[model samples]
Target: MNVGIGLPIGDPAALLSWARRAEAGPFSTLGLLDRLVYDNPEPLVALAVLAGATSRIRVQTEVLLAPLRDTALLAKQAATLDRMTGGRLVLGLGVGGRDDDHQVAGVPLTTRGRRLDGQMEVMRRLWSGQAHGDGAGPIGPLPARPGGPEILFGGFRPAAIERVARWGDGFLAAAPPTWAGGLFDTARAFWREYGRDGEPRLVAQVNVALGPDHVVDEARAAMHAYYAFTGRADHMVAGLLTTPGGVREAVTAFAGLGADEVMLYCYGTDPDQVDRLADAL
Candidate 1:
């Protein structure tokens, strides 16, 4: 199993520092969380900086909310990042759930799933250089590659699983064990039914903070902040808080469940937090 670290997108200096450290850490990849019109910096721009800063670690957007932006523009940005990163970009995408997030983006929250699906289709066409003009002629300049970055779909719903099987290169499972089990099973089944070879690549994100003290209070505080930001407190409680053993156990569990990669977010921007996790992992 490959391990990756999530860089805090809210702090530019800290993000850069963490990227530098991650290039030398045990992690094989560096991930950035996406939040438009929130405290977080733009994932694509942050990734651009990371592309220039690191040479080896793969850069990923743990997820960028697809329904919140223009599909063609996003494809261009992702392609540019992939080119800049020397084809080391993994684009994880989702249809956002938070109403306030959509409000911030000035888009309606309803039908986000449908919009996301459409956006994905359009992006694939644009990336593959098959997108056509209004009269069905070839469109403008294409992405650096004939196909764009590897795209992964994130969520634990049945529809999400189906979407991943139909259109994505892999799955990004985010729910706790109960929800994740069903989603994984569904994804595998869909892959088999679609005649795809092997299993789809799975990437799981878990909140982690490592220290000798097993800081439950700190973990809970971080969970609260995550909930406050994402507004999905109820869905994440069990999987979000962790002791040292819990962190190890979570990693073991995800590995056992066939995750190809795991990205751990250490809940805060403190360098000490990153150091603790680096030591623990």
Candidate 2:
């Protein structure tokens, strides 16, 4: 399985130092998380900065919130990023689970799932050089490929998995490997039903921090801050792997579960965190 690392879009100092270290680290991909209505930087913009700063590392929006932005605008930005990155882009999308973000966007929390269903098609058409019905043509600096990027959808419910089967090129499970394995099965079943060949990409994510005694506390604190909007920070923060052994064990487990890739998210963004993860690998 391939290993990737996520850079924080929250704290600037942490993002800068850790992004540089991560660029030099032994990771196959570099990624960012998305959110609005917070002090966090915009995800696509942050990704653009990281892509400009690094070479040979695939950059992506690790589940960009799609329905919050205008569909055509999102497509243009994604295609632009694809061109800027020389085609090293994976667009993992979802209707994010936070109500505040939706409120901030002035869109209803309800109907996002349905909205994304159509949004997916619109983005594809724009990427394929098709114009919107209003005579607005394809966005400039077209994608490096016919389609914008490899599309992956994230969520764990039946409807969510069905959407992945219908529209996405793959599935991204933000849960633990053991939990993600079941969702992977659903995704595979739908892939075959849709007449796709081989397999759809399967990616897993784990929040992590590696260090001596004080690192666990740091990681825990970071998790609480990072997931504060989730309303389940206490439950979510408990999953972080703080030791090298735990990290190795989780990687092995995810590989066993047939994951195509797994990304490690560092909440605190200490430079040592990236180096230690690289050494652990």
Candidate 3:
């Protein structure tokens, strides 16, 4: 299985440093998490900059909250990025779980799932050179491909997996490998149910930190703070892979589950961790 690295939470200099180092490393993709209510960098814009700075590794949003953005604008931006980056963007989309995010974006929380479904439909049409209105011309800056960039759906719900068959090219699993086999199975079943051409790509994510004891501790603290909104930070932190052996084992386990890629979410902002993870792999 291929291994990808996630952008750490940090300032501009630190982020660019990590991205540059990550590009030179043996990583397959560079991923970023999304949040509008928080102080995190906007995933699309940040990724565009990182992609501009590097020519090799693909850039992805681990899971962007699609319901929070205007559908047409997002389609334009995604298509532009896809063209600019030579079709290296993997749009992992989700109906967000945060009430504050929806509230702040003026989108009702209860309608997010349905909104995502409609948004995907509209975005696909827009990306395919379809006009938005009766007299309106098609959105400019078409994507690098016939459709838009590759799309992956994220969530643990049945509807989310169904989206893989309906609109997405793959499933971005947030669960650990041990608990993810059934989810992947459901995704495949839906893919066949929909008469999709081939297997739906399966990608798994894990929180990882490697270095001295202090770095691991800092990584755990960062995860706890980031995911505290879920009320399961301790449980999540307890599952973190802190050693090279642990990372290797997780990769093997995910590969055994037929994952196409494994995204290692590094919670710390040290650029050196790029080499550390590459060496470990």
Candidate 4:
């Protein structure tokens, strides 16, 4: 199982330290959460900083809200970052689910899905130097990877799976239990229909809490807080907190589900908390 760590987008200093530590540790990639109108920094820029701080660890946007930006510009930025990182960038795209997110971007939520599809098409074209006559000229000096960064679509719906098959390199799923069976089935179907004759890459994100029995409650509470803050309380109760196994069971379940890579975001932004989780793993 390939393990990756999440970089805190809300705290620049802590993010830099976490990126450096993750690179120095056993982690394979560094991921950033994306939120445009929120106080967090832009994902691409945050990735650039992470690239400069780490040598081998790959950088990824856990799920950038693609419908909220200019696709051509986003593609150009991604290509530049990929080049700077020597082609170690993964662009994880998603249509924002929260209506407030679109409102903040001045984009109507009603058109998010269509906007995402259109933006992805334009972004792919620009990345491949096929974006001319759309008035956005060429995005020269592409990344070392011929086509550009690996594009992964993030969603659990059937439409999302089909979109990945049509346009993405892979699928980025949420934590297990909440996003296991249905999500995997959709990915497999998409792969059988449109993927190469090999295992399709599947990336998942989960909260991690590692320690003796002493910290189990703290970890559970932290995980609960995460879901509540994200408005995913229903999932937290039904999929996460309903069981006694907690984070460890959740992590093992994700790996057992054939996840190619799993990124763990410690419930809180505490570096010590992350360290505890890592040590336990």
Considering only N, C-alpha and C atoms within 3 Å, which residue pairs clash in candidate 4? none
Cα lDDT, all candidates:
0.76, 0.82, 0.90, 0.74
On lDDT, the leading prediction is 3
In angstroms, give how far residue 278 of model 2 lies from its true place: 0.7
Compared with the true structure, what per-residue lDDT tens digits does model 4 show for residues 1-281? 88887754445768887877777777888888787656667888888987998889999998899888877778778889888888999999888777677888899988988888888777777778774455656876576677778988888678877787788888888756555656877887887888457756888877554445434455556556445657766566344222225555666777788888888754345565456546656
- Which whole-number lDDT from 0 to 100 does residue 253 have in model 4? 79
lDDT of 1: 0.76
Candidate 4: RMSD to truth: 3.3
Candidate 3 residue lDDT tens string, 131-197: 9878888996999977899999999989889999999999999888888899999999999999999
Q: After superposing candidate 1, which stretches have Cα over 4 Å from the reference?
A: 135-146, 212-219, 229-238
How many times do residue backbones clash in model 2? 0
The C-alpha stretches of model 4 lying farther than 4 A from their native spots are 210-231, 234-248
How big is the RMSD of model 3?
Answer: 1.0
Listed in order, each prediction's TM-score against the native is 0.88, 0.94, 0.98, 0.86
Model 3 has an lDDT value of: 0.90
Q: Could you tell me which residue pairs clash in candidate 1?
A: none
What is the C-alpha lDDT profile of model 2 across 1-281, one tens digit per residue?
Answer: 78998765547556656667777877877778787876677888877777787777888677899999999889989899898889888898988878888999987899899899989888888888888768776665689866778888888997888777788888888898879889999999998988888888998898888887576677788779867876899989888888889999988999998998989987764668889999999
- Quick one: best TM-score, which candidate? 3
